[model samples]
Target chain A: MTSLGRGASVALTDLEKSYDRVAAVAGVSLDIRSGEFLTLLGPSGSGKTTTLMMIAGFETPTAGDIAIDGTSVVGMPPYRRNIGMVFQNYALFPHLTVEENIGFPLKQRGMPKPERAKLVGEALELVHLPGYGGRYPRQLSGGQQQRVALARAIVFKPRLLLMDEPLGALDKQLRENLQLEMRRLHADLGITFIYVTHDQEEALTMSDRIAVMNDGLVAQVGSPEDLYDRPSSRFVAAFIGESNFLPATVRGMEDDVVVAECEGAIVRAICPGRPASGDRVLLTTRPERLRFTDGAWSSSAPQNRMNVTVTEAVFAGERCRYMLQAADGTAMVLKEPSSAAIRRRAVGERTEIAWSVADTILV
Target chain B: MNLVQAIAGRVLPTTVVGLILLFLIFPIVVVMVVSFSSATYLTFPPPAFDLRWYKAYFGNEDWLRPTWLSIWVAAAVVILSTLLGTLAALGIARLPPALRVVASGLILSPLIVPVIVVAIGIYYAFSRYGLVGTPVALVLAHTCLAVPFVVTSVSASLSGIDPRLQQASLSLGATPIGTFFQVTLPLIRPGVLVGALFAFITSFDELVVSLFLSGSGAVTLPRRMWDDLRFAIDPTIAAVSTLTIVLTVALMGCAHLLRKRAT
Candidate 1:
């Protein structure tokens, strides 16, 4: 069913988008591999959806070009572009039944009845809503209607699939179920999937690689693990998953590691790009990265120690989260498995939190 | 929350509504009562029952011809106004917000203007083009007067439909004209029917424009009624008026059914 035979990689070269002289996407260039689940993750007005719409051929770019299979598609109409789109509202034709709506694209291409019905049947089965083609859109629930819309979009098997918050309208349980179904569909269909959303967890869950956008520019593009472990920018570090920010000044550098001073607390981190001495930097670390200990720090251990007081200890089912404060009031968040031993370190207790230099990514 | 208190509260408003309804329907009841009067003049009640006036109206050949012509002219008006007004409403619905208001105002402006003004203008225009004594002049004059009402009803109903229905069709790969016929026309069917009914009734019941534009050789039913009223308050004219009232009530009933279908 793959028209391009596993689909050609999408590439945008110096793509710029502007509306009424206000730059929405600027000099943004990304090469998305074939059969990859790529999600453009950003907050509203951050140019993520604009980039998707531009790729879908709905909106014209003020400058630059987008190409599939190395062929530029500038000034191409949406219908002629052969790109499938799933909108946020699930814009289904209310007057048409499920069968007719799914068969619409096939009918447009002048496919014969037997062939069109056969294809529509297959599309319905793909979304697991078989034998319900006679129903109208309004008769179905939101999730059912969304599935029909999805079936309609992919019924013709377009070369590239563009989804703009397609599952954002569904409830949590249904969204999660559809997310897994969508991943399987992507694998089976073998088409390049370009999804856009502002939800960080959604970006991390279904995406093979995420392009985290900020201020009309791509802040970082990497796999979920790469983004979480080694974010290249301050925005990425803060945007994906939670992170504790420490205002610090670089004090020393040794073997890809740098020692920094956060208020009176000294912290060690891995800095991207060589840094000069006394440079002001943002020290970033995840909640799960820190370990609580009662002993003194080892001299040879590639870790730093900060004396902290657990101001708030919140229980989160599987994990216990401690909101700690340093002597100088620099806040630290730490998460640990809710073991009996961990719970014993109750709130308003003083302790030492330690983490290896590799756990931190200096921004 | 008291039972009798709440019941009384609702009944008082209903009582007021019933009073208003009586005030509005009294004139039509009086007209019907006087149409059957044995006396030659209109009164609250007849001294004796008679069918002579009804028989006289059916026997008059002059009234019969004009009434038949008026039926076909009103039908022509319905057909013309439905097509033109529906298309105009659809066109205006697609216009940008600022232009939509302007287009709607232009289309419905005739309703608020004086009908006599349109009658004089159409009379001179039809006479200048040698169409004054013909049926075409009556059709044209009636169509012009009825179109604004059609436009008003159509635009109101058209605004109630979902605009995304059109977008969904276009995305489904249907062309613009195909989408309009297959999707938009079906969704706006009730509006078109209502507009047509308004056009037909307005043209059929019209007297002012027909009086000005209609020549002596081409009198409509209302024109014939006017001529009959000049010499005497005859029972035959009252019979004709009663028939007209019945026809209107039936037409309005159909309009009500159409509105229900829309819902």
Candidate 2:
């Protein structure tokens, strides 16, 4: 296989796509670095796929511009874009053999037959489907077909690759294995990859940076850790993983932390932006971060504590989950690792939960 | 009472279906048997088996001329209709839903209209253009009848294909024209082949439109066969009928096999 070299940087400036007065992708502007695996992650109808399609040149934007490596590609046809794309359904030509399908693009480029065959063989090996070139697409299993599709897309060594939910139809076990393989391929090729998927875990696992989209716009774009640890919005916090929100009244700001009062108890949370005193805000934290104050080894660090009654308790295999109601009737959840040495809290039990100020984020 | 109902449910449908099958096939069987008769005229229960009528059909130039005309006309119709019909189907597939329904209905109107009505219209229209009694007239009229079948067959095949295949081809750097030849055409080939076969059979067996157009210059096999039956009753007519039946059935069988392979 030819070395792909460094990938191209892509920039979308106020890109928009609408049909009959209804917008499918509304004003999305994002900058993707060269050789980075950027994932457009969202739920269905969030315009992630539409945004990817526009970048691939399959869809013409209603307004704004798309630039690849500082060159405008907005009006270019898909065939002239020189970009590689893989669809969710593994859109292999049903009549063509695996080798023919992979060599199709090279043939269109007027590559000699012998040279095309060589690249096709190397691509098949890269996708781990060596020596299966003579078979038709219908003869292969679903996983095998997807591998062929990936091989076909990358066989020509396109600098930039676009994938739209490529692993969506596979079973969970196969999807996980392919996900690791894709990540390995990305590292090996040093090519920029723009992946679109609604699976949050897939995005978090594979992306160098993720753009979480909602309602046809980017809600937040950051590294997975940044989005999970310090989400800038309530939607980002709730969408990334499980979160507990506590309504609080901001007293004042102290440096980067906001001092707030919640459930008649004083609390401090790290805020991304400054909020005025008396501002009502929601303080969010992960369920696993809250600990029972009665336990020994409680740290001497400043902790935000809340007094609550356990409304529900269930002993999961890996952890004990407690649903609690604060004195002001605000519902919250706390999870503790399952261990025989730790006492389990029962329903109706009153307890004080403590978490460090660093774990709480004011959104 | 339950046993009677059960027997009636099973026996009634079986008897009715068997009777319908016999009703449909009995005439063809009689014609086929008479074609092999040693008699001088058309008659069932042959006194002896012989190939005299077949030999007569092969020897006579009057009969051979019309047969060749029919074959050539059908071939021309197949070529013209398949090209037009395949293009029509492709255009229809890309149409918006509401307009698509209207366009398809218009294309298929030839099938829904009465044959005699279409024949009369074609005859009057072609006479004004001095196309009557010409091979071009027969081909044009037959193409009108055959195009609907081609459109229907090709449309069925087009629907079975995944539209994303074309997009994938385009994104892989193949031009639109290249994508159609490499991906779209190969995938929808079975439908096109079936449509061509239908077009050929439609022209070969057509009698009503041929009657209007095949005056004296272009006398098709069906037109000559009608003349033979009306003027002279002979076992030769039975022989031609058997041959026509075999050709039509073989063509239909080919179409059926193509459709099966496509699925």
Candidate 3:
């Protein structure tokens, strides 16, 4: 119940790691705030795990510096860094009991036997594994072993914790439960947590800020809502969640929004930078944002509308997903909440889909 | 045809296995029976049974000296070989894949090379250093033969453990050396123990190398038995063989128990 160590802010300056001249983490620079739960979300081979290893001192950076609380840890050994790390495979010591494993770091620091035991007990309780300390790691199930690994990592009260896909080996159901528990633990401990995972949904559910990585570089870093609602690049948009990308040409600027012409229709979208008129661009929007114009819903704000033919429709339990083809032969998807009040459109039906201009973004 | 094939599949292997076991065990049974013979000459199916040969083996100073020498040399080999072999296995495990193959094959070459060839080379090498007749010579030579077994046993268990456990220990604030002692060493202890037992047995039962390096001053039990067998038809050699077989089996059982406890 007591708070863990105070969080330490980390600053990675131009961190780079390469193997045989091929860069795994190519020019990554980010400032992580204290007490933040930041998830590195990316596909495999995106260098997310490699970056985490650099911070943990397992992999030496080819260039750049890693500073924790304003102190450089470039050449410092992992032991001297005083950081906590949880491996994906739950690397628990098979020779030691749970209590001994949790007490390992404390014992290394020369904490007295009695004090170490007390801290180990508190750690087990923190991870909801009380009274299981006497058992060996092999005696416990996979989830329990991971909990013990977590307890061991935090029992030393490390200022910064790095987890490399800690919940990766667990089943989906257990992974979901542990994700919430990890979030609660992050809140309670108030220590910095840098997690690496390829699962976007897990990152979205847990991270305060998610760094979406692609091709060995960070494409975008922002809050989960910021990433989902306004992705900065095509890679981020496609990696984070499903998006309907439409090719368009810039016509002119309307105040701050860019007016783009798509499929012979005028579409207005928000762009962070100004584009010259007649420049080609791509626009992206969420499926759920698109609605059939035949509905009674109407907004006073200006909207973007497109006519499309339903190529495929699936009546999902909670939502109806319809695949549509635009007039220019571009594919798009529309999702609507299933309700008896709204009639479901059959395949091959032509309909006009409307969305607010605010929901659309030019990437 | 199906019934005939099934009977052959089961009965053929059972009969072959039974014959092979009997062939392997017959010499040991013969020696055990001969150890209890009252006949002064080495003879099987003795007219009467007694313990004179066992008494002669236990009471003779020449036999006792060699037995003690063998035991002490084996103990020393176990200590030296286990330490060296465990370190070698650890080094091999850390090597890159291409280099690891070369290093592992080099370490295990003694196992594949003929013992007589190794003995001749060691004899000439140790004789040049004037160590051919000393206990140190036997200990050193036996350690070379014993080390390969230790390396093999320890390597099997070393490869079985998760390398991440050491990384985890280091990340948790344990120094690299501390991690080895606290985590790595304990996990591979069963393998080390098994290796030590193998080293002991290898040195204890060694004859070809002892025949080459073990002069009169450092004659091991196997060398003394060989000398007795070539010079005289003594029943005392039978008693010694029986005792050696018992010691080897008991040590092997100890190794098996340690392995079981570890798992």
Candidate 4:
């Protein structure tokens, strides 16, 4: 088969997959642009793995189209997809030498002997394991074996590389190192990298854009900063990064801002994606956005302030995290510079935590 | 008191194990002893040691022909059944759990059924098709008898293999078929060999099916021994039975080796 040309974007339109009518992936529609690195970030069983498998042509989608470069690949077998995929288990052929395993795909594609050898060589070089071709998979360490998997995937230069938690099996330090390596490889090769992971930190550090998934649906799609600073929903606010969500009722509305009251306190927030006026709202603010105050809401304070008692304190490297309990007893987590902390509060100390209206995003 | 109790605990189990071992091995020992009896009749602790019976086995033309036929037919059964059964096992292992259980039951049903009923049906069916008394008939019936063993052993072996081994092969860019041939077949070969040995031994030792199905032209060793028993009790017969026992033991040893290699 002739190889599919580059600039062929992988677009899934209303893709749905169900197993025994359980609806594993419920109406997942996505556009993964050519040469873009997109990570599908979600907790386990949220259907991110299913969606990735569907794109790799392993699990057939129950409904909708998956097109590569505008060509529908609904019933195409994985071998014919011209797509590279890495499994969580790092499924290298144990019987074959590492060199033979790397050459396997090219052999299947009927690349001539000389050409296949040249390509395999280039791949080994790219992965920095140039002389590892003769070694068996068992002979190598976990990280080296993972590098072999990556090299094999990129050897044929498939238009898209689908990774199903490829680093999920590695140790923490190894996983982070692979994350940075993958980010660099995705940039250097200019191939569309569709990464799947449950680790929020991994998605934040490596991807060009992240699609936060929950229960088989794309919850939110945005750059890291966008997802961090202005999440569009309560799920997104909680799933993407840690955030303090307070159940609040909208007190009033400005041009685009809403004043929501919770636990005998009022705070101004930008309406996240514009929920209706007078609606029950979820007010979210990051821990770093919160600042410790001297037990009073100053008139010149940015916009929103609440008086609460610090119930617990944690010492993070550069900051001290304080858990403040409002009168209604909803614990709010906030971080402040360690030096500026109020002598590091004990369990029952009182302090007012404040943030600007610009800091809180109401959904 | 403590020393006496410890001695009794160790000696009691050893004696019990010795009794079980003796009970299991006594038949083979008696058979070998009776084969060498100079009186030319079945006896335990043979009255006299002699090579006359062994010589009688070689001199008898009827005995030599059927013995060779049995050996050749068993080899054929081993070759054909192992190939078919291994492929079936691989396909069955890949199927969903419910389908796999159903397929396995159907394949192994012959083993569960009574041999007399199977022999009778095979006899009537072969005779009607003009296949009775031919070596082909015996070989085919024995192959069917051997196939389930092949299926079971191969399936057991394939089950122990990691399924992700195939998926790993595919993600390496090899097609599903390529993965099966290269990665899967090699890993499951020990199981296949174990099945092959069983298939060979089953065909070699089979009596009822051969008796009912063999024509004038086809005479396996067991069938020959059965016919000889009706006519007369000969020293050559005892010699041949002893030889068959030795060969069966050797084949079982090979099976043991194959099973250990599989793990």
Candidate 3 structure quality by residue, lDDT tens digits, A10-35: 99899999999999999999999889
* Model 4 chain B worst lDDT window (10 residues): B164-173
DockQ, in order, for the candidates? 0.44, 0.88, 0.91, 0.47
Docking class of 2: high
Candidate 1 residue runs with Cα over 4 Å from true position:
A1-4, A296-301, B1-8, B33-41, B47-60, B150-164, B235-263
Best by DockQ: 3
lDDT of 1 by residue, A214-240 (tens): 989999999999999999877898899
Q: Write the per-residue lDDT of candidate 4 for residues A220-323, one digit (tens) a residue.
A: 89888889988988899988778998889887877788877887898788874555557787889998888777765455646687889888889887888888
Give the poorly placed runs of model 2, Cα more than 4 Å off: A1-5, A295-297
Candidate 4 residues lying further than 4 Å off, grouped into runs, are A1-8, A275-277, A295-303, A316-319, A337-342, B1-10, B33-43, B46-60, B94-99, B161-163, B168-176, B230-235
TM-score for all predictions? 0.90, 0.97, 0.96, 0.91
Candidate 3 vs. true structure, TM-score: 0.96
lDDT of 3 by residue, B133-222 (tens): 899999999999999999999999998888889889999999999999999999999999999999999999999999999887899999
Q: Which residue window of length 10 is worst by lDDT in model 4 chain A?
A: A1-10
Taking chain B only, the TM-score of every model is: 0.90, 0.97, 0.96, 0.93
The candidates' interface RMSDs, in order, read 2.4, 0.6, 0.5, 2.0
Ranking by DockQ: 3, 2, 4, 1
Q: Candidate 2 lDDT, tens digit per residue, A1-363?
A: 233348988989998899897988889999998899999999999999999988988889999899988889988999988888999899999999999999999999999999999999999999999999999999999999999999999988898999999999999999999999999999999999999998889999999999999988899999999998999899999989889999999999889999999999999999989899999999999999999987443787768888899999999999999999998999998999999999988899998889999999998
